[model samples]
Each structure stands twice: as structure tokens, then as C-alpha cells.
Target chain A: NAGVTQTPKFRVLKTGQSMTLLCAQDMNHEYMYWYRQDPGMGLRLIHYSVGEGTTAKGEVPDGYNVSRLKKQNFLLGLESAAPSQTSVYFCASRRWREDTDTQYFGPGTRLTVL
Target chain B: LAKTTQPISMDSYEGQEVNITCSHNNIATNDYITWYQQFPSQGPRFIIQGYKTKVTNEVASLFIPADRKSSTLSLPRVSLSDTAVYYCLVGDPRITGGGNKLTFGTGTQLKVEL
Candidate 1:
């Protein structure tokens, strides 16, 4: 199985431009998350979804929006890209179970905003 | 949410064993400790996870003391391919109060040389 996959492996955006990053999972996981990793720093949570039609803010939710319109898809949007928004974005999914805490991650999408 | 502390970087040679430690002073009773490894330009992959005592897997081992205040990720017989960033995460996904959030601190960068 593909597990989790992200669209647009890489992207470059200018200031004020907008874009969306797509995350999809084939494992029928109930939870999905979006995180950004900056150089020399750890990943910070951006947004997450517990199930279809449910979304929540994370530690670093500013400058981003998320939607979980479908059970297998979670989308992250940048209304106005900024230089600070440039980072490697990762998407992850996990089956919501007490016994299974492992989260499956996507390869990642490298974004550069200038 | 519990915050994790880890080394910024570590250096090792091939065939030597490596251990990375992480501290989480405020870890809750339901919290679990998990580790992830990331290669350059790639997403973080699961390594090992534990709550207390020790847990061993094919790739690594996790050791948590009875207090659960800290954890150690041990990698045996390191190779150049093992060079990457290792992150220690502490949290519980089953708790709805936190929305299953995960906090990732600046992970330890392990560099292995031949």
C-alpha cells in the first residue's frame, strides 16, 4: 500500500502568492496531520484532522488553513505565501487506536517562498 | 503536552554503537515516548517507541526508566547510512483534550563516518 502520499513534491512561490498542499492516505487512517520543518529546527505542527469533516489548529497554525473534506484527503492552504513560510512540509496519518500510536508519513513537499 | 529535550548533534563512526537521550520532565501518566529518524530531504521515519523499561526492535531499542522522565534510543553497529536526525517525541494520541497533537523539538543530528 502507498500508506501516505503528498502532491507536488516541490514548489516555489513568490511573496503574496498562494498555494495548496495535498495529502492523501490509503490506509484508512482516522487521523492526519501537517507539519513544517525549518532548517536546523524541529518540526512544528500546523494543522490536523481527526476524521472527515473535522479539523483543528495546531501549535503553528498561523498563515495556514486546512480542510478534511474527504476521509482519505487532508489539504493545507497558504492564503498568502511569505518567505517565512518556506520549509519542508510533511503529512502524516495514523490509525486511531489505543494499541497503535505509530504515524505514517509522506515523503514530504519542499516549498520555497521568496 | 510534554516538551522534549535532546542533543543538537552527535558524531559517530561506522561499526560503533550510538545512543541518544531525551528528557521530558512534564510527561504525563498517559504519555508515550516515540522516536523518529529523518534522512536529508526526506520525511521522518519511525524508529522505536516505549513508555517505561525497555523496548527492542530490529532497528533500535528504547530504554525508559521507571520514572519515565527520560528515554534513550540506542542504535547498534552504526553505518554511514544511519546518519540522520533523530527526534524524541512525548505525547498520547488517545487523549482528545490535546487533539492528538505531537510536539517535535529540535532533534539530534547523528553523523556517521566511515
Candidate 2:
């Protein structure tokens, strides 16, 4: 099973351009998350959804928006990309189980905003 | 939120055992410790997780002390492929009911050389 897959492995955008990064998981997970990783840093959550139609802000939610219209899909949108948004974005999903909190991540999408 | 602190970098030789420690001073009662590994240009992957005592998996082992203030990730017989950034995260196990946001700090970069 393709645990998690992201669209557009790499992209470049000028400041103020907008784009959406698509994340899809086939594992039927109940929780999905969007995170960004800067150079030499760990991943920080931007937004997350506990289930379909439910989204919440995360540690670094500013300048980013997310939608989880379907259980298997989560999309992260940059309304007005800026140079500070240049980082590698990753999507993750995990099952809602009391015994496990393991999150599976996508390959990641590299974005560069000039 | 429980903040984690780990070494910025570590170096080890192939076939040697490597241990990376992370400290979370303000961990909550319901928090669980988890470790993730990331290679260059790839997404982070779950390595091991535990609440107390020791938990062993095929890839690594997680050791959480009785106090749960710190945890250690042990890698046995490391190889060049084991070279990656290791992240320590603390969070609640339940995701559907809320209050399960993971905060990641700068991870420990493990460099395994031959």
C-alpha cells in the first residue's frame, strides 16, 4: 500500500504566488498532518485534522491553510508564498488507536519561494 | 507542549553501537516518547516509541526512564545507511479526541562512517 504520497516532488515559486500541496494516504488513517522542515531543522507541524472535515492549527500555522475534505486526502495551501516559506513540506497520517501513535510520512515536497 | 533537546550531531564508526539521548524536562503525564529518522531529501520515518522502560524493534530500541524526563534511542551495529537525523517527539497518544500535537526540535544528526 502506498502509505502516503505527495504531489509535485519539487517546485519553485516567486513571492506572492499561491499553490497547494496535495497529500493522499491509502492507509485509512483517522489523523492527518502537514509539516514543514527547514534546513538543518526538524519537522514542525503547520496544520492537522483529526478526521474528515475537521482541521486545526499547529505550531507553525501562519501563512498556511489546510483542508481535509476526505479521509484519505489532506491539502496544504500557501495563499501568498514568501521567501520564508521556502522549505520542504511533508504530510503524515496515523491511525486513531490508543495503543499506537506511529505516524507515517510522505516523501515530502521541496518548495522554493524567491 | 513538551519541548525536547538532543545533541546537534554525533559521529560513530560502522559496526559500533550508537546511542542518542533526548531530554524533555516538562513532559506531561499523558505524553509518550517517539523517535523518527530522516535521510537526505526524504521524509521522516518512525523508528521506535515507548512510555516507560525499554521497547525494542527491528530497527532500534527506545528506553524511557522511570521519571520519563529523558529517553534514549539505541542503534545496534550501525552502518553507513544508519546515518541520518534522529528526532525525539513527545505527545499524547489519542488523536481523535484532541490534545495530541507533536513538537519537534532540532534532531540529532548521526554520521556513521566506515
Candidate 3:
């Protein structure tokens, strides 16, 4: 059972280019998130969705956009990729529970901008 | 949104019980402590989370003091496979507007030896 999967495990883009990172889950979770991890800076949230057809900004949503068109899929699109936007991107989902919940993450997509 | 601080790295032997501490000096009353494990070139995976006192699951345990100034992640009988970077996240308890779009700290790298 692929819990969470991200497409294009690795990608390279030029400055000002545009691309989309795809995340899909089979566990029927309602929460999905996108994040980027840089050296020494940990992971910063880019965007998230509580359910299908809804999305919101996270801690570092400046250069990213997200869309949740379906329940099982969350897409992260970079309108204009910059060198600062180059980082390892992760997609995660959460199972609802009271007081506490756990997040499951995908293998991640490494994007390098030149 | 609370800020968290963890060690830069730790060294432990196989089968040893390792405790990684996280400091959240400014933790609000509506904050929850969560931990995730990440290997090289992969997304961070959930380990444990707690609001107060102690909480345990099959993988690890989480301990939070009454003041909520700090939290500890305890890994019992760790193995070499457990050699990875451990991230401490402080998420809002009122995880509203969306699913918990967690914020990850710089994290602590735990190296398990033979």
C-alpha cells in the first residue's frame, strides 16, 4: 500500500521556469500538506488543504501554490521557479483523531534550480 | 506558532535508549509537541507527539513537562536503522484552517553505532 507518493523523484529547472509536483495518497486522509527542506533550516510548510477543493498558505508559501482537486491528490505548482525555491519538496497527509494526529509523508521530490 | 530548538547531533550505541530533548521556551498553551524522523534524501516520518505529561506508541515515547517549556523524545533499544535526523515540531493545538501544517525545527541528527 503506497501510503503517500510523489511524482518525479528528482527534477532540475532553470530560473523562472514553471513546474508542478504531484502528491497522491491511498489512505483516504482529509489533510494534505506541501513543504520544502533546506540545509540547516529544517522543513517549512508551503501550502496545505483540509479537504478536497480547498487550500491555504503555510509558513513559507511565498513562491508556491497548491491545489486539491481530488480527495486523494494534492498538487504543488511553482509559477516562477527561483534559485531560492530550489529545495527538497515533501508531501504529507494526516489521519484525524482527537487531541492528537500523526502525519505520513512521501519520499519527497528534489528540485535543483540553476 | 511556537518555536523549537533541538541539538545539532547525537551519538549513541546500538541497543541504547536515546533521549533527544527539545526546548520551546515560548510555547503557548495551545501548542503540541511532535517529532519526526528523516533519513538522507527522504521526507520526515512521524515518530511521536504529545500535549503534556507522557505519551507512548509502538515506536517511541514523548514527554512534556507541566510548564511546556520543553519536551523529550525517547527511543528505546535503538538500532542502526534508527540512525537518522530527528525533527521536533511545535504545532498549534487548535490546528484550524486546515490539517496540522506542522512546523519543523532544525532537528537533531542521531547516529547509531555498532
User: How close is each model in CA RMSD to the real structure?
Assistant: 1.2, 1.3, 1.7
The 10 consecutive residues of candidate 2 chain B with the worst lDDT sum are B94-103
TM-score of chain B of 3: 0.92
Clashing pairs for model 1 are none
Please provide TM-scores computed only on chain A for all of the candidate models, following their numbering: 0.97, 0.97, 0.96
Q: Candidate 3: which stretches are off by over 4 Å?
A: none
As a whole number from 0 to 100, the lDDT of residue B108 in candidate 1 is 95
* Leading candidate by lDDT: 1
Please list the C-alpha lDDT of all candidates, in the order they appear: 0.92, 0.91, 0.89
Better of 2 and 3 by TM-score: 2
By DockQ thresholds, what CAPRI class is model 3?
A: medium
User: For candidate 2, lDDT tens digit of each residue in A67-100?
Assistant: 9999999999999999999999999998646566
Q: Which candidate has the top score in DockQ? A: 3
Candidate 2: list runs displaced more than 4 Å.
Answer: B95-99
Candidate 1 lDDT tens digits, A1-60? 888999999999999999999999999988899999998898889998888999999989
On residues B22-105, what C-alpha lDDT tens digit does candidate 3 reach at each position? Answer: 999998887778898999988888888889999999999998988989999999999999999999988774666746666787
Docking quality (DockQ) for each candidate: 0.72, 0.70, 0.77
lDDT of 1 by residue, B78-112 (tens): 99999999999998867865667888888999999
